[model samples]
Target: LEGLAGELGIADRVSWLGFRRDVPELLAAADLFALASEEEAFPTALLEAMAARRPLIATRVGGVEEIVTPGTGRLVAAGDVEGLVAALSALVSDPESARRQAAAARARVEREFSTAAWLGRLDALYLDALGQRAQAPRVAAGERPA
Candidate 1:
């Protein structure tokens, strides 16, 4: 890939960094995050990018739509290279829009997918379960167990 990058005259534009551990830091340094996967399940990396407040361009697949909604980012049909390129070009050409979208993504992640939000949901579920349990019929004080 490095040789191909050099042959294509894109060696300078592309970094061949491998097995990076500082993903958040890398995303912080990046202008945008691009994912061209044809299929996805959780798309945790996209979430990481959003949490990092980077603009997004990802193929629309699986749970991506649930995360990358209207204002958060741009989505292209999977395998649609032209659409992907167009979206990427648009985001790069319009820095203000990209920044706005990235901000919205970050805000959405914090509001909807943050750890606090998950814990809040868990608390609600437990509260609901406890409420239901309380509603179940109970034997009188001295009655034998049913």
Candidate 2:
């Protein structure tokens, strides 16, 4: 990150805090959250940003598309710098629209990714797995199960 900052001639423009315990507070103080991962699986940072009610700009990769809808945030193709720039520009140019989108993102997170919702989904998945195992035909010792 330091190298990149120097290369971009914006060393003064960036502050790289290695690890932070106050992530929620930091997120809440931000105007926007941008995630440019090339690939990701259910990113908790994205969810945190959503929960923080910040407008988001994320690359369309992995579960990001499923989480960031049109009304909630902007989605750009992975590795598309121009698209990312446009997304940021749009949000910066339209504060009211950005706020509206931020609100929707927060609502979506609260409605679908809340602790109760996650726990309920996990319980359902475990139940389904157990049910499937129970329905499997019993096999004799030393015999292969079909």
Candidate 3:
């Protein structure tokens, strides 16, 4: 990758920071985030990027669609180089739109996927299960009730 960057005359603009622990800090400093995974299963990086208020350009796969809704981010088909390039170019060319989407992403993460929101959903599920259990026929210890 470094060799390719050097060949492309972009080594000066790129940083090959292989594996660091300060991911949150990195995300906080980014203007935009791109995830070009061929496949993903509930990508936590997408959530982190959204939480960090960075515009996203991710490939359409797995749970990406469930997260990057309209006005939140751009999703292109996996392996579509042209689509990825277009999405990145569009977001970069329109700063205002990028900012808007970033803000919306943060808001959506807070409103729907936050810790509080998750707890609320869990609470509802438990309550519904309890209600169903309560409505079930109770049987005596010694005999079954018809």
Candidate 4:
């Protein structure tokens, strides 16, 4: 909250919607989710915005790098105040761009991280015989899981 007030220079305009019961309403009211967090590991907040079809502006940190790709969100280096400001301004002034990015983000999440894909992989493994599992380790040939 202090970060926002300092960045936007509108500390008085800030509203702390802490523990709001109307999640959908709150999400719907927002055009973007902006976070300048220095530490983020698979940030659930950004993921939630993607799921909610809201565009994001976040610092490029950890798993956030993997999350915001192309049209999903705009990422700036952590502590780059000017860059963050520029991104926030651009998105705020152009609602259409925000919506487009939001749509694309949601689509990417659905295609890449959907529960259906998870279940399908589980079912495929279930269908595979013990011999198939024995034939090849699940590391995709030469590639190893990092």
Error of 2 at 82 (Å): 1.3
Clashing residue pairs found in predicted model 1: none
Model 1 per-residue lDDT tens digits across residues 35-119: 9999999799999999999999999899999999999999999999999999999999999999999999999999999999999
> Which parts of model 4 are misplaced by more than 4 Å?
1-11, 19-21, 124-131, 134-146
What TM-score do all the candidates reach, one by one? Answer: 0.86, 0.82, 0.87, 0.74
Task: Write the residue-wise lDDT of candidate 4 on 49-102 in tens digits.
Answer: 888899889999989888889888899999999999999999999999998999
TM-score, structure 2 vs. true? 0.82
lDDT of 1: 0.94
Rank by TM-score (best first): 3, 1, 2, 4
Q: Which runs of model 3 end up more than 4 angstroms from their true locations?
A: 1-13, 142-146
Q: After superposition, how far is residue 62 of candidate 3 from its true place, in Å?
A: 1.2
* Tens-digit per-residue lDDT, 1-146, candidate 2: 79999999999999898899999999978989999999998898998999999999999999988899879999999989999999999999999999999999999998899998899999999999999999999899999977
Model 2 worst lDDT window (10 residues): 61-70
Q: What TM-score would you give candidate 3 relative to the actual structure?
A: 0.87
For candidate 4, what is the TM-score?
0.74
The pairs that clash in candidate 4 are: none
By summed lDDT, which 10 consecutive residues of candidate 3 come out lowest? 137-146
- Clash count (model 1, backbone only): 0
Report the C-alpha displacement of residue 50, candidate 3, in angstroms: 0.3
